[model samples]
Target: MTYDILIIGGGINGCAIAREASLLGLKVMLVERDDLAGHTSSASTKLIHGGLRYLEYYDFKLVAEALRERERLVKAAPHIIRPMQFVLPHENAVRPWWMVRIGLYLYDFLGGKMSLPRSRGLRKSDTLYAAPLKHGGSGFVYSDAFVDDSRLTVLNAIDAADNGADVAVGVAVESARREGGIWRATLSDWRTVEARAIVNAAGPWVHQMLGSLGVNASSNVRLVKGSHIVVPKLFEGSHSYILQQPDRRIVFAIPYQGDFTEIGTTDVPVDAPEDARIDDDEIAYLCEAVNRHFTTQITTADVTSTWSGVRPLYDDGASEAKAVTRDYVLELDANGPALLSIFGGKITTARHLAEEAMEKLAPSMGFRAHPVSRARVFPGGAIADFDTFHAQVVATWPFLGEARSLRMAHAYGQMLAEMLGGITDEAALGPNLGGGVTEVEARWLHDREWARTADDVLKRRSKVGLHLSAAETAAFEARWNAMFPREPSYA
Candidate 1:
């Protein structure tokens, strides 16, 4: 059976596109090379921000679009996305105070002000009194949103499936050819499938997909690898800090996972996309940046976890990789049935990108363009008020501790009801999977959400891997494999 649209990648972009297209009465199939969001999507800095620094690059339109989308995501999925405060310490040398004020003013007005609070000024003394910083300086407090990037991608795929789209994880598209005015595609898993229109949303591997189709890509994407490090909690507040390095690049020290602190993101260009990894130099760079402003001295040993992701940036001939555009570029080849290729996009603007892509494809697909935007809600996002939802969840599972119930409700949203099944107490949650992960959550992932391996459950579906010890991970893997054996183990 040929699908109306076949999306390659299964990252946020592909999943978002599939969800929207499927909801619009299109037969869509999304194929992922590995586990969903195994690469760049899961490796993001995990913030759904408007890219306040993009103001420096004169990307007003991009910033405005992202700002709008950020609020939309927070409202739609209050369980996974929440508003976050960021403190930007002002240094006299970085930029003039008036210029900073002007940028913040534009940022506040750009999104049309809904739930997010507007940016506010702060004196060095007053700011430090509330949330103490290591190196004292005047600061400005602004608002942004944080997201569970891995879970968000998975939820999109789940929602697409619920809407009648065929979502395939652990499946790779080997070739895509245009024949008889339709796309003839071969996917590699245990078998292959064919489709009509092919979407190359393969993120970093997009160029390779174009090459396999014998199509010459006009726009080249520069793969830049960004790395992050996690350490023990450094600050006491829910607010995150944006630190300025001597080199002018900024690093974020954000409160993470209730107890840990997440610091990151060094942009280094790479020759090969798959070669993206955290090197010693990059680790040192991140540590040095954090040490420059933080009160607590963090060393290499303080680094509990490290991760890396490759950004598929549209090359603009910029000397600095960090300066490359975060805005997405859509390329459509109108040779036959059309192939829509996505270049650079952030997690915040994924839904907007999908809407824009669908508008471009509508003409070729012989359908009149409709203003069908997915701005309302995604699956598991039916909660109108978070406080009421939290109260209900806690009330229902009185046996489970408040923290655990809150975590599950926040992580799964209305889907948490389905995951809990008829369980009434903590005992029914099954054996502790270490960290806060329970066996019930693992079963939910395996049975419903396409989680096949222990790593898929621990690393992606839940972050138990980060909090678990080596011995605990080994025990959990043994238990997981014994419960559900795979014919071919995930490599």
Candidate 2:
């Protein structure tokens, strides 16, 4: 069966587009070469906020749009997206306090409605007590939101499936061609399938997708590699720190996973987008950035885990990779049949990006642009109040204490009820998979949520891999294989 829309890439952007299109009554099919959110989407800084640094680049429009989306997402998925405070320390060596204060005021006003707290100034004596900076500088606190980026992608895919879209993981688009005024695309999985309109939302490979379609267009993506390191918690509070580097770029040291501190993101140009990896120089750069501001010095030895992703930045002739625009650009070739290629988008703006993409494709899809906002609750985001929802889950599953119940609720949302179907006692939740993760969640992910491999369950669907041992991973892999054999790999 040919689909009205065939989306390539199961990253956040692709999945979000698939969800929106499917909800609009389009027959949609989503294909991903690897695990969903396995690349850039999962490797993000994990903040859903306006890019404050982008303001310096004079990207006020991008920042303003992202701020609106940030508010929408916070309300749409309160369980997963929670408000976070950021402390931007002002050193006399760097910029003045007045400039920083003005920026903060503009940031708060630019976003429109003020669901989050306004920015506030902090005295050096009092602020240093909380942040404990090595430089003992004054600072300002502003609001942003934290997200489980991987889960956000998964939830989008799940919502798309619920809206009657065929969401396929572990599937690759081998080739795409325009034939008979329609896209003739061949997808290879355990088998091959075909489709009509193809969307090239393949993040880093957006250029490659265009090439595969035999379209000659100027290369638009400038691949910039960003890396992150996880360490033990640095400060005592929930507030994160945005430290200014000597080069004028910023680094984030945010609270992660209840017990760890996540710091990162160095912008470096890459010769090969597909070959993006973290090297010693990038790691040293991140460590130096952290050590420069914090009281506790951190080296490579303090890093528990490190990850790298290639940002699909739009080429704008910037001398530095950090200066490249984060705004997405949609390329549509009217001369060729209907092919849409997306470039340079962030997690915070994905929903708005989808809306814009749909607007671009509406004419070709034989439909007019419709106003469909993602401001409403997504699949598991039915609960209006997160605290009340948690109470309900705890009351129902008394065996699962507050902490565990809250974890599952946030991870699964309203789908937590369906995941908990026909299970009451701890034993019914399935075998201890090691870490706090259970077999029930793993099975639900496999059977219902399109999770196919051990990594999909451990690394992407749930972050249990961060806490599990090497031996435990091996054991879980064995069990996963016994239950579901790896299909022939694609792409």
Candidate 3:
């Protein structure tokens, strides 16, 4: 069947666009070469906030759009997106006090009718927050939301599938050409599929995908690598810290997996998207950034895990990688079969970007202009209050422990009932693959969430890998391969 839209790349933008198009009564198909969000989408800072730093570049429009989306996502997916406070320590050596105060005021004003508390100034004597800081200076506390990034992408794909879109994972679009006013795409496995229009939402590989289709476009994407390191918990609070460096860049130290601290993000330039591995210099750099603000000092040895992702920013001739704009640009070529290529979008604004994409391509695909509500809840994301819903889950499942109950509530949300399958005991959960990886949960992700390998289940669908031992992780891989022998392997 010729789908009305064939979306390439199963990252957040592609999945979101697929969901929007499918809901508008268009037959859609989304094909991903690897696991959904196996790249850039999953390796994010995991914050749904207006990029406060972007204000320095006079990017008020981008910040406002992101803030609005942030409010929408927090309400639509309360379980996955939760409000968190960020403590921005004042450094006399970096940004001036007046400048920082003005920026905070603008941030609060732009984020109108926020569900979270407004930004406030904290004195140095506020022991609760200041005790952890090495520098004895006042700071500003602002509100933002955190998200389960990979799961958000998967949920979008799931919603699109539920709306009659065919979701294909581990499928690569090797070549495509305009044939008889249709996109005839040849897959890596040598299968051919036709679609009326093609949406290239391939993150970090947008330029390469267009090259493969023989469409010569002038705009090039600047590949910027952002790396993060997970270390032992540094502070004693649920709130995160945004530390400013003497070099004018900021690093965030957030609470991760309940026990570890997540510190991140160095802006380094790279030649290719595949070269997204963190180096020794980046580790030392992040450690130094944390040491500047926090009382505790860390080195490379304290690093537990590290990850890196390449951002495909639209090349606007910015000298520094950090200065590149985060705003997305949509290029629609209506010369033959419609091809819409997206570049430089963040997780917070993906839904809005998807909505605009459909608006541009609707006429070419022969669909009337149909608008979707930003408040539309994703699959398993219907709970109004997370704490209340989690309490209800614990009440229903008396055998579930506190940690397990909260994990289920956050990961599965309303779908926890179906995942539980009326089972009532830990033994019935079937083989705790160390951490929270039970046979039942593993099978649920494999069959329902398109998780092919142990990594997909342990790392992406659920962060159970952080809790699992090395031996247990290896054992889970062996079991998964032995049971699901028919599917392709994933990294």
The prediction achieving the highest TM-score against the true structure is 3
lDDT of 3 at 239: 89
221 Cα displacement, candidate 3 (Å): 0.6
Q: What is the C-alpha lDDT of each candidate?
A: 0.84, 0.84, 0.88
Model 3 off-target regions past 4 Å? 486-491
Q: After superposing candidate 1 on the true structure, give the runs of residues whose Cα lies further than 4 Å from its correct spot.
A: 123-131, 489-491
The list of candidate 2 runs beyond 4 A from truth reads 123-129, 190-194
Model 3 lDDT at residue 2: 83
Candidate 1 has its poorest 10 consecutive residues by lDDT at 123-132
Please give, for residues 1-491, the per-residue lDDT of candidate 1 as tens digits: 68889999889999999988887888999988788888899999999989988989999999999998888898888888889888887752377778888988988988887698889887645654245566575768888988899989988898889889998777787776888778887767645556667889999998988988899889999999999999998878788887767777889988888879999899999988787789999989988887767667889999999889999988888899979999999999889888999998989899899889888898888766554554667668889888899999889888767877777787788987788869987888888766666788878888788887889887787776877899999988888887778755222
Which 10 successive residues of model 2 have the least lDDT summed?
A: 123-132
- Which should have the higher lDDT, number 1 or number 2? 1
- In candidate 2, position 415 carries an lDDT of 86
Clashing pairs in 3: none
Candidate 1 residue pairs in backbone clash: none
* TM-score for each candidate, following the candidate numbering: 0.96, 0.96, 0.97
